[model samples]
Target chain A: MTAIHTGELVDRIGEAVLADPAVVRLDGGPFQTIATYLPGRRVVGVTAADRITVSVVLRLDQPIPAVAAALRERVRRVAGDLPIDVHVNDLESKEEPV
Target chain B: MVTTNSQNDLRDAVPAARQSPAPARLADENGQGKTTIASNVVQKIAGMAAREVSGVHAMGGGMSRAFGAIKERIPGAGTSSTAGVSVEVGEKQAAIDLDMIVEYGASIADLARAVRRNVITAVERMTGLEVIEVNISVEDVHLPDDNGGDEAPEKSRVE
Candidate 1:
């Protein structure tokens, strides 16, 4: 298996997580701790280390656990051997206010 | 905070017949992830559902309703949909409490029942969280004559 760089891995995971319809946006965990600090920019809500952590705000249309499970599955395909931690920090309604 | 062993224990506790029909609703140990639903989301859903019932004239007690009226007049101070609705949401279940004003002549008991059913259905279906209980409190009754005071304000002496 070809090893991917940490920076690239973070981007890949971010893209994958966002592709899921249930996820509204990435969230920086408490105090903005969960993130990947790059040269000039940092990706919020995703960190790569001993274990990968991703926090997100999800839409309320689906079951929370089901969405979490799907997210982990998607991240796992990109992350390979690293364990993943998914945090669903908040939920948003699907309807738009008039 | 959920560990693999605890998930295994939960799996073992469930009846075999029940386990075969559906996937587990709770988070599993296989690194699937953890999901937390904010209480306010459930509160909003419950509030909307309660208002859908015919007899519910409004939500909240006298003081809150008065406050809500004043808040509505201010720019960018939109009315709170969750007013008079409180919810406790757990990983897999939720409980809701509602304060409501009913229209006069409506049967309180029947109205409560209808509101409870709608709230449970809406919350469970929308959020996928089991609504264990919905407690309804009828705070007041809205009389038709009561609108006279609210509809017409006293003329200002200066104006």
Candidate 2:
């Protein structure tokens, strides 16, 4: 496989992770350490180095592990052999009455 | 060489998963990556489950209840669902503590048992965390007479 640019790969991984219904949004973990800084913008919740770290706030409807496993699979599709790390920073109650 | 070495150091400093005193029950680590569930998620689930019991009038101790009341008045300052709940979550198990007010007619012991069961079931089913114990503190009972004024506002106005 052709080597992909780090910035492009990070962006693609972010998109793929968000596509999962169980994910509420990508989260910047405590202290905002889980992120990738690009030239003009930064991708929150995804850092790619020796491994890829993706942090997220998930909807409470699904089991946390199942969602995380699904996310790892999704990231693998774009990230290739890089190990993926999923951090669940928070949970959003989607069904809670306003 | 220096830059690469520093990068490695930085990576090492930040652990792949959060460091907690207790093993995180909801965080599952495997070859692909690690998935961690925050403690607050368990707290919220326990709180919601406790509230679902028929006898539970409200959650939280006196101070928090008062604070919650004030908080509810503010527009967009939503009431906290986790107000009266605290949880200790481990790698494969969780313990919950709850403060609640029961209705006047309900039996406290029975109420506690029902709330415990509901909370354990909800937390286990939703997050897949095993609930080892649920400690419920019945802070107060809601006396029906306390709200009599609201029900008979016209009587007071006429008097």
Q: Of the candidates shown, which would achieve the greatest lDDT relative to the real structure?
A: 2
Error of 1 at B45 (Å): 2.3
Pull out the clashing pairs in model 1. Answer: none
Error of 2 at B78 (Å): 11
After superposing candidate 1, which stretches have Cα over 4 Å from the reference? Answer: A1-4, A29-39, A47-53, A60-66, A81-87, A94-98, B1-23, B64-79, B144-159
Q: Write one digit per residue (lDDT tens) for candidate 2, span B2-98.
A: 1232344555676776443544444433245555567877887788789988989889988778887787787644457877888898656789999
TM-score, B chain alone, candidates in order: 0.70, 0.68
Each prediction's whole-model lDDT (CA): 0.77, 0.78
What is the C-alpha lDDT profile of model 1 across A8-64, one tens digit per residue?
Answer: 889999999999999998988556777888877888999777667788877756666
The B-chain TM-score of model 2 reads: 0.68
